[model samples]
Target chain A: MATGNSEVVNNAKALSIEVDKMSKLRVIHYINQFYAGIGGEEKADIKPEIREGFVGPGMALNTAFKDEAEIVATVICGDSYFNENIDEVKAEIIEMIKPYNADIFVAGPAFNAGRYGVACGAMCKEVQEVLDMPAVTAMYEENPGADMYKKFVYTVATGNSAATMRKAVPALSQLVLKLAKNEVIGTPEEDGYLARGIRKNIFEEKIGAERAVEMLVKKLKGEAFVTEYPMPAFDKVVPGKAIKDLSKARIALVTSGGVVPKGNPDRIASSSAQNYGRYDISTVHDLTSETYETAHGGYDPVYCNADSDRVLPVDILREKEKAGEIGELYKYFYTTTGNGTSVKNSLAFAREFTKELIADGVDAVILTST
Target chain B: MVKGIEESGIPVVHICTVVPISLTVGANRIVPAIAIPHPLGDPNLSKAEEYKVRKRIVDKALHALTVEVTEQTVFEN
Candidate 1:
């Protein structure tokens, strides 16, 4: 898996295999057993198979590619087998795929079928990350795999079922052609794909304030306008059960309020923190102004710098520990700056520390944010 | 971070000045704090008074951690 200088997936990769501009690009298509003309659920356990040309939906994609590209091979795997033994199947599939020296990889417009969509997403992710080549897939936005794999694959948004196969192929093929030809792809709207939550800076004709004024003018006149930045989707989780007994439960303190040692030892960003700090608080009973301070840059830091407990609440929690109101305070506290931090990075930080908390038998977490 | 820990099956109470954002982000247990700069502190009061105030808010947060909640809930006292 070698990456070229271009880090942007939409940007043309540094071509390793010679591309004779006029030659028909070789394409590899992935499909499930059902699409390979195999029996339905009974044959869902069928092993991975490679064939000479296009399969079911591939027929439509092949037509869309027309003379510009052709499906040189079709790789088919049963949904059950692929998912159950994902790693084994992925390696096997890549070995099957490598011989084709294919220009691009394309997987299902799996629609709403959960397992199939996951397989397609998983395969596309593997192809992109392992082969270091562009891969495309299509699925409904609500499909489980779409959320899991959309960031890794340039997923073409499609309707909920195969009934929309007619509309999905052209879009998928267009993106596949662009990747295969190493052409620059455009925005999700201009190109027919789902928003991958990737940001690309571009120069515009108008200045920021001018555009904002124009958009405000349109809004006042009841005209439609698109927002430059869209909020990331938030997932609602089923809350874990509350502690049965506070005195018996070990508690941990974590914060986006960014309380670190006095000198900012870890060098965490005062805003938009790319990393978090886990400081040992077991030896320290209280967060004194001389020992600890706030690193967050969003609000006035004077208060937090004076008493870091205002944000982390370490002192009161220590008092509670002495009173046996709580079993004990965790020795370490996790912290990061909340200001200007993306939801993606925040989620990543939490997921990483929760594993350690779980291992340490922490029963509950108190999170403070400014 | 609150959502992450909670989703991983550890009960978590979020202490933030922005209760609406906590609710919108699906935090199961929420505790409204004093202000943006100091979530648990009120600098206007004397040191002893501020400590008591911080203690009260923190006590509420601990209680919120112990209470059973079926959906997003704000704990304010």
Candidate 2:
């Protein structure tokens, strides 16, 4: 074991890895059996739980993520997400993450430990796929999950054991920040994101059409040309179900996909929002500066914050409500930030929100997605 | 949201311009609009066109509320 040196916190030594300091990013972290401060082997069968702030290498991760973002939430689960009751665990953990506002997600600094690596790889892939978000996890090059899910997510190769935790976090953090900025990342060799067994364009100097044409011409002539764009293919979410009826059902409008007051007075973060509050607009025609405000951070606040009713369509729905075209429109509208939102968290919110609507006898929903 | 509401045992009439998402999330009834960002009306268009689009889609969504369907159905606008 890499002993003696482990006792002291070496934040400076940990962050000494060179990186593009210009990029600013926000990040969410995921952890496993030991690092969650959970006892390993003894606690290998641990279920998922939510925690705020840093745990284990999370301190190093925070420093690594400095100027980039705060590590908003640290989700901890065991290797058992696959070995034990996988489905329930995934669902439960996903539900746990719905409320936070985040720009990027990171899982494991899973060193060389095989099971831990697999766990990290799987979790990162699941997050990236289901949430339509960016995710990264680190594992030893030899971990089996590395082979399985590395192609799907950003899985970095690492040395064996916790001794490498310092090295792992910075490598993963750099890639994660680049992801948040929507900047092009190279293959595993260049950017440290697990190689997807495919190469993509990562332009060094120029961008857009002119560069694209130059690269294309080089490729056509069988000459070497570094591409300017390397976009990862996203898995399409299977569409939402079709509604049965419209005119007769009492339809209500709901948006937590961040419909807010124009000024964003509540100052909600786009990806990892912690606060969720419903504004009272019972007496107002449309949400105004004094009447209602936004806590959502998914978009440019000016438009939605100035007129939240536009995003929620409260006025329009109210107009429908007055006509008695169908039935009563629920007065309270739910709100939350959708940027960098995780599937686990969103579903949990959905289940809770469903209960509220049910009790109120709300018949239907007309949700707008940004 | 409509699909989520319906999953909780209430009926819903999902209004979306994105036909694919509406169909898959299991919304019981759906009404197609012009585009994604503005499902009812295009903000850039003339008021007449906006109203024309909104009136047509909104009418379909409202009408869908009255009808019963065994499976997912889209209201043609």
Q: Write the per-residue lDDT of candidate 2 for residues A107-182, one digit (tens) a residue.
A: 8877644446656666666667777778888876645556667778878777656777777777877887788888
lDDT, model 2: 0.62
lDDT of 2 at A13: 51
TM-score of 2: 0.42
Quote each prediction's TM-score: 0.51, 0.42
Full-model lDDT for every candidate: 0.85, 0.62
Could you tally the backbone clashes for each prediction? 0, 49
Q: Enumerate the candidates' DockQ scores in order.
A: 0.30, 0.11
Q: Candidate 1: deviation at residue A311, Å?
A: 46
Give, for candidate 2 chain A, the lowest lDDT window spanning 10 residues: A234-243
TM-score of model 1 vs. true structure: 0.51
lDDT of 1 at A212: 94
